[model samples]
Target chain A: MANGTVALEEKSFYEESTNKYSGILSWLLTTDHKRIGLLYLVTICAFFIVGVILGILMRLELIAPGPTIMEAQTYNTLFTLHGVIMIFLFIIPGLPAIFGNFFLPLQIGAKDVAFPRLNLLSWYIYVIGAILVLISLFLPGGPIDTGWTFYIPYSVRSTTNVSLAIFAAFVLGFSSILTGLNFITTVHRMRAPGMGWFRMPLFIWSIYSTAWIQIIATPVIGITILLVIMERAFGVGIFDPALGGDPILYQHLFWIYSHPAVYIMVLPAMGVVSEIIPTFARRTIFGYKAIAFSSLAIAFVGYLVWAHHMFTSGISDTARWIFSLLTFIVALPSGVKVFNWVATMYKGSIDPKPPFLWVMSFIVLFSIGGLTGLVLGSLATDIHLHDTYFVVAHFHYVMFGGTGTIFFGALFYWFPKMFGKMYSIKWANISVALFFIAFNMLYFPKFIMGYMGMPRRYFDYLPEFTNLQVISTVGSWLMGITMIIIFANLIYSVKKGKKSPENPWGGVTLEWHTASPPPLENFHEIPTVTHEPYDFSQLEEMKHESK
Target chain B: MNEDKQNKENHEHITPYSTYVLVWLALIALTSITVTVSGIDFGMVALAIAMLIAAVKSSLVINIFMHIKFDEPIFKVFLMVSLFTLVIIFVLTFFDLVNR
Candidate 1:
């Protein structure tokens, strides 16, 4: 009943006498899901920094003319490493495994995710995968140049560390599958007594949907990457075009997982936005069932649209048409989500807060990204746009604009609860502003240059594209500087910011019912949910009369 | 949280597991028969019969193993969504191949 009042309560979990140890041991050997989430926060930040630095370097190399700093081969290795690190390492596991793992069980009024040890195991597996990839970077033959796609024949013929790279991907895919399996079981088995399926938060719904994509799709990538490794190492002919194997089969296998893997990345970000928008708007989410079902719908339809990525790969015209149509179908659910979010904010007392602002920006940027995606989905348009900077800009607009923007939004929304301290929101706002401008400036020219026949993954380009590339390079540095400022603000907050209460944002979710940086065991007693999440009116009535 | 409602519901009797077993077994037997018939090369007749048997088998599996037949309508909706995805993927892929 006290939980219905929307106030933070200090409990045994936050007691000074508890075994919540200080320093490295607390982080390394902790079983607390919050601590583990923090560990992920730390690890992913490091990986993100590495990935961002790679991006800056790549942009710099492309700045002046013909390879300013590194040679073309080295540039190839840089972007390949960048793509592999950012996609497989950072974005795929971005929102769900880290934040969803930390927050979902708490949000659903459960003590922990269904399998806690397996949750910890996922982190270890992820680290091992990261280590293997880094090792591949140093291996003989100067890292793989076959791009992250690792298309066969090129992968088979290339004199790079293909086995090491693909094997690392295989390990990471296993980690992804295990995380997905754990999330599915937890959602099914671990909800509290009165917490029905419909009562669950939109964030949890997003994770639930993403979990299915992971369980069903990751294995195909695993098998595909394994066959590539076999072809490279053991001389198995599954993907080897030279050895009676169809290279296109390799593309089918890779995109089957990889395309939906994009959904896996963005769906959770959408979940993050759903949570942010309602809390900030001070209202119940508009059409909760529609938004929740849309997440699942996106995940379902997302699987069929992968072949659209292959349309320009010389697949049959019929395949192209089918994939094109399916691609349009896939956009419908995402459209539903965008519409629902706007409707949720329509008449509500809107909070111009950081998270809300980021969500709004996400809508604008992701719309551009999503609409361009439809352009690429059209068979005729994609033929011209395929493998160009148009595709590059389109993807980054969705990915960076979609997932990357939400990553910052979630950091601001939940940073207090996660760290038990509030970040400097002024700095946070500045970071968002600078990031938005720089991000667009960096990627927007890509569309223009791409249309002008500038191909992606090339170290050198014609003189015609020089001015646009120069402007984009400047934007990349601004983005880099903004990221550094963000890191500084985060560190400053951790060391010395206002100690936060549990319900800092006044959110109407079970997570807000618990302590900031919740306990070793999340709840003192298991909760029985009564109200739906985002019942902000009830929360308001309770808060005002009680005060 | 109310446990009393759940206890009262549990007191009411339902169909026995033996009935489910019989249904499952019968479905499996029909599946084998259809597979055998298909081997006889009855042209489109064999293919149609085999597919019909497969559908019956899947229904039985969902009804018994997955227990959707006894479930609330929402569960049917969820199951339908999953089945729908399978249909979309297979149909589109089939159309792509056949048309090509």
Candidate 2:
């Protein structure tokens, strides 16, 4: 592959694109999208582990009612930190900040995102925001214990350093906005010669939709967080009821962004599934236009359902029912996606790789999560299950079970391509199995106990709920072990795994046309698409070229 | 390719100084209208009138000063999508508040 001169393919991205810096400075200051992606991957994974440990500690406290592992105040702080780190530090940036940065340009046949400098700036802003959140923990006011929602009256009055933490979130919102702007520009201006809108990969479509949500919805949260910071730092009557600010209005503002923000978390996961299902099934994706358009539909409908979270929070009956109807309406596009994925797999050659297995699990678990969400979306059922463990279980099944699984699913599918090495497939399979079982055990019992009237965010429970609590605690332990094994398998592979063959899975996306751990600029020559995305007839040609 | 065509359409616009001056004058006049309406106290409609004038002023800046007029049609579509999202949020929130 190497000629007399330095071609982009002669050196892998790891050894190329230094941007004139060397050593640690090369990484910290590098504007290479791939390197910056790895930067986000490492940081986000660290926050994920921190969030997981906080969760395990919280579960330990609930193992036996009444001061089992810590004080009630300590329990309050733990759950708050868990939600904060998981949602903001981990999942919000989980897929887009990492894989989207790495693969979006590659899939679109662009050398890099439209604004490479702005892309790197997004990562730096993310790091600065993360640091601010961490610094707030040790500050004099104490850790933010208002839960991730930072619901006001309490958020405004809490003695903890809520202002700094909310300020951190405000800064993170900037990173989200800038990243979104970069992707939109990239999609609009940098698509390859023959890559039409319909010819592009579904992952690009989903992330494109997610970028719009990030641009449109994130600023709302940015403004809401600033208001909380101001009301706390000074006596601004914005959110505090005592100061004549409406607490309900705060709920309205918070959910307006945070609800659509959930789509920001899941839309890309859905896109990843759309990519993987067809590759494993060896078929063109069914209803390509339908899947693509549904992404936009989901984003548009997701905005109207924000008030569903505020259904029980003193919102008017008209708003509650209308939002409830819209919440149910949002399920239509998700159903379209799930249907298309399963249909694409029908009567096609299917390979049950770890990535495939993870998504298969995602289909079942996320369905349960989305369907159970309807129980909450119903105005009456929500009033009953509003703050209970049922609510807790519902989101976890969707979020942790949904996006969280696909996050790793994508990592496994693209791991070899990203690192030029393959993970231990046997161990990867075992880890996914353990994860599925452990995850169900941890959250499933919450539904039963919650129906029996157990509320969330509490350290103690009735003696009758003790059995399920113990099961949940043990499940958390199992989940902790499974995570460690998955990391061991992946971390070891990053350094010592066997070399992966090009087009290892015979994928047909634009990214697969190039070398594994592709060169700094991604391709030896830019590809001009002539067939639709996921046309499996191209697989044989890719296999021939790779060899 | 479509992207190339779009690129060709971009970075080629040259707005005359006269256009900028006209847009700026229109903005200033709209601002005075906003202030004038606020003083008249048209009750609840006062805020709506001010917002309407502000919207007109912004369209002048967007179309002329910002050069959206010279850009491809796709950019105008993008602007509309963003504004549509904002309008939906406001209308939906007002539904709750007005009913309450």
Candidate 3:
């Protein structure tokens, strides 16, 4: 086949117009999965840059104990805006919408998602949500001052554009639900001949499991957001204490979705690590079934442990004990995954590439996040750590350090295949080194100062926190500067870099078998699978040839 | 593909009109029972009974009107899993509420 498809180079999705539309209109109106994936990649990365800038600014303000830059209300609005934009616009829809939408069909040996037009519609919905958030900032009452959680009463009372902002989140959740439904149906019915459940990639498993959480957990956030809007609009008193409604109920409903939403964020990143680890290690995956099932286990147990976020919010002791136990239980499956990834690397000819290096950082940082998570998970320690920077540092470690690191890894891992371009591996490694060092300097101090009683989301702190705050602030600048190098390298390479080989990573997955920047239909003829997913022995002739 | 289609066609379910009427009557009867139970208020157990009735009514709607009775086993598995997850959420949420 011509580069794993019957078509010529002109038939690739990036080439001349197959559809009538071309240029910007082709992009907007096109339903091609790869194009939509690129669209999302650009959009979310733009939002990520904005979020990072806001974060750097926030740290700049906090560098001094007193008001360094903005007013207290501005700081409040800034963090809220930062949280809403990052959570709703960037990360939540990020890996799944970008990678999952792009690769789910490709990985499963299908031409496109089960519903192509619906796939496009979900993207439109996501864009609509992003637009709504942007418009809210300029609206009459100003942007939402409540955090992304939109804890009620405060949300109801806040004199900001809470309704419109939260309504955007509701719309975003709808997009997630549709995408979940599409992926689940695609996986169930659209696998190529002989590509059974076990034969699918671990990334598909993670995405599939995440699809369930999207379908099940996302609706709770949707409902909670609507309740917040309703209470704000009509004095519904659903969550207002002054009107005899319960505030705690809002926290419960919010985290019920948001907590599992963390799994939604991290699981696909885990799936990426699973794909990268085996490829770089030059070995068969250690425990494919174990990792696959643990994704599901984490998804399920993740749901049952949402109440852990509410431990200090006046929930019952029964709830505290029950949720604490469930929290520990959820950690088991995550540990299972970390164990399997390490085992996969054991004794293999490790490549030490950019992606693998990111995974190495992922293991160390995610484990720190996970281990400290146990401290936060316990009833006694959480009492000490609750609402402190410890909690903030913990999530950033897990979410940003872990999932965020792998985000870079997956980008680099797939960039060659996606763009048919290769950048300097040496430069990529330099960026990763700076990224890890700056990341630790930024968040690790918060863990210590947090334990010593530094509260989260404050305008001013005691004099003692000043030094650590300055270090953290300086670290943010380095990390922000490093991001420009990393992203600029990739973007420049897309136009001018060397043409990547077809199977650049010697990946045995369906995506690698096809051309770099595969044809519009993904494959000319969907190939049948007769072997295991990670059976490297079958691909001896396909060993990676470095460019 | 044709054989699978034929098998699916052969297994297609068509409930009798009388069966639909019977389910409708059962739903009505359950709704009446829920109303009666609400009036007599057996405290905590009453909420459980209400949910149990709601569950029965929905399952009837699912299996009969939704045609899950003649659908593939996987559909049934999905339905059961969804219901079980719903129960888990409710029980856990109420555990906090009641204990508090």
- What lDDT, from 0 to 1, does candidate 2 have? 0.90
- Residue-wise C-alpha lDDT for candidate 3, range A123-216, written one tens digit per residue: 9999999999999999898988887778766888899999999999999999999989988999998998878889899999999999999998
Query: Model 2, A1-547: lDDT tens per residue?
Result: 1111123246888887657877888888888788889999999999999999999999999998789879988888899999988999899999999999999988998888988989989999999999999999999989988888998888877899899988999999999999999999999888887888998899999999999999999999999988887887787887776788788888988998999999999999999999999999999999999999999999889998999888878888888888999999999999999999989999999999999999999998999999999999999888899999999999999999999999999999999889989999999999999999999999999998888889999988889999999999999999999999999999999999999976688788888887778888887777777778898887766655655
Q: How high is the lDDT of residue A207 in model 2? A: 96
**Of 1 and 2, which scores higher on lDDT?**
2
TM-score attained by model 3: 0.94
Query: What does the lDDT read for residue A195 in candidate 3?
Result: 86
| Local distance difference test scores for all models | 0.83, 0.90, 0.88
Superposition error at A379 for model 2 (Å): 1.0
RMSD of each: 4.8, 2.7, 2.8
The complex in candidate 3 yields a DockQ of: 0.70
Model 1 chain B TM at 0.74
Give, for candidate 2 chain A, the lowest lDDT window spanning 10 residues: A1-10
Model 1, span A1-547: residue lDDT tens: 1243322453433342124576665566665666667778888888999999999999998898787999999988888888999998999988987898789888888777777778888888899999999998887886878888888788888998888988998999988998898888889878887788899999999999999899888888998887877787788778666677777777877887899999999999999999998998888888899989999889887888888888877677878877888899999989999999999888888868777788888998999999999999998888899999999999999999999999988888988877789888788888888888998899999989999999999999999999999989999999999999988998999889888766678787887766676765676667767787888755654455235
Query: Which candidate tops lDDT?
Result: 2
Q: Mind giving the per-residue lDDT tens digits that candidate 2 earns over B1-100? A: 3898767856587888897888888888888878777779689888788888878888888888888888879889989998998899999998899898
Give the higher-TM-score candidate: 1 or 3.
Answer: 3
Clashes of 1: 0
